[model samples]
Target: MAVRELDDLDRAIVYALQENARKTSTSTIAERMDVAPSTVRTRIQALEADGVLTGYHAEIDYERTGLQLHTLLVCTAPVPEREELAERAQEVRGVVAVREVMTGQENVHIEAIGRDGDDLSRIGRELDEIGLTIEDEDLIRNEYETPYDGFNVASE
Candidate 1:
């Protein structure tokens, strides 16, 4: 697929959505960008169709929901099977997210949440069953995110 080039308006729209998609309405973006609401809506549709904008996800705080352990499972999978195993790992209980890195080793990173050590062990075992060699595990303390500044049209 050809990459879709984004203009200033598209960048600004993406920046606004990244800041708060749920609260950022087309009308609000229109007001900020001085464009019509319909124009903003059309741009958003185009962005989605082009795959520049994916799904909007909620920022979850697992610790507040009783899942105390937020762990990063560093695993290594054979390069040929890495993608398949990463997708399969998502189906494992307690697994929240899986990332595939383009490296020779420690190429798969799995994010999982568990109530305690026993739950984490089960998740680890399940990952191992799926052909991922567990290399290390780290308990996450905190995570933070902010809108990408490059997409901030005002900055340009």
Candidate 2:
């Protein structure tokens, strides 16, 4: 997709939303940016329509939710079929996310949460059934996120 140019107001809105999409209200962003709430709302709608702002996602702590196993399943799928296999991997029970990297080996990375070893084994079996070669499995300790600094253009 072609990149869209974002102005200071657009960048500020995206940054604020990224920081806390659920809690950050349009009014709040307007207040922070000293703009009209309607303007912020319109800009947000435009951003979404333009595919600049895709979706808001919750940061979940799977371990706290009693699903102890947070595993990163590194797998390789035939380059021709990688994207399709990644989408299929998302349907697997216990699978949380599937990332298709632009690499030959270890191209598909699946993040999954399971209660026990058996559950993880089942997930792996399902993935294999769909023609992904499981290269390695690593337990995820923690993940952290921060909003893109480039979106803080208003501050700069």
Candidate 3:
């Protein structure tokens, strides 16, 4: 499908949905943006069809759930081993995210969540056993996120 250019109204709709996709209704967005409810719905449908509006998901707090440690593991492997190493890291118990990074000293990055330092160390060992050399580790203290801030450009 050809990409659709989103107008100002469409931008407003996206911003509203980003704030709260499940609770925010089409009518509420229409009232806020001063457009018809059908217009908001139609635009949302088009956005989804165009792959702009992806799946809605809830962001869970791991600390609240008792899995408190959030660590980023950076490792380097032989070019042939990068894919396999990343796949193996994903199977690790505490791993939350894994990515093959191209531009950096490290070739692979893994985000793992654990109950504590021991759990994190166990996860690191699991990856190390797969031939991933641990180059660096960073513990995430906190994260502040605001979704779709760029899509709210209509207000600017």
Q: Pick the TM-score winner.
A: 1
Worst 10 residues of 1 by lDDT: 1-10
Winner by lDDT? 1
Residue-level lDDT of model 3, residues 48-97, one tens digit each, is: 88898888878778889988788889998777778888888899999988
Residue 34 accuracy (lDDT) in model 2: 91
Candidate 3 steric clashes: 0
Q: Is candidate 1 or candidate 3 better by TM-score?
A: 1
Tens-place lDDT per residue, model 1, 34-116, is 99999999999999999999899999999999999999999999999999999999999999999999998999999999999
Ranking the candidates on lDDT from highest down gives 1, 2, 3
CA lDDT, every model vs. true structure: 0.95, 0.94, 0.85
- How well does each candidate superpose onto the true structure, as a TM-score? 0.97, 0.96, 0.76
Residue 89, candidate 3: C-alpha displacement in angstroms: 3.4
Candidate 3 global TM-score: 0.76
**Judged by lDDT against the true structure, how good is candidate 2?**
0.94
Worst 10 residues of 3 by lDDT: 146-155
- CA RMSD of all predictions: 0.8, 1.1, 2.9
What TM-score number comes out for model 1? 0.97
Can you rank all candidates by TM-score, best first? 1, 2, 3
Clashing pairs in 2: none
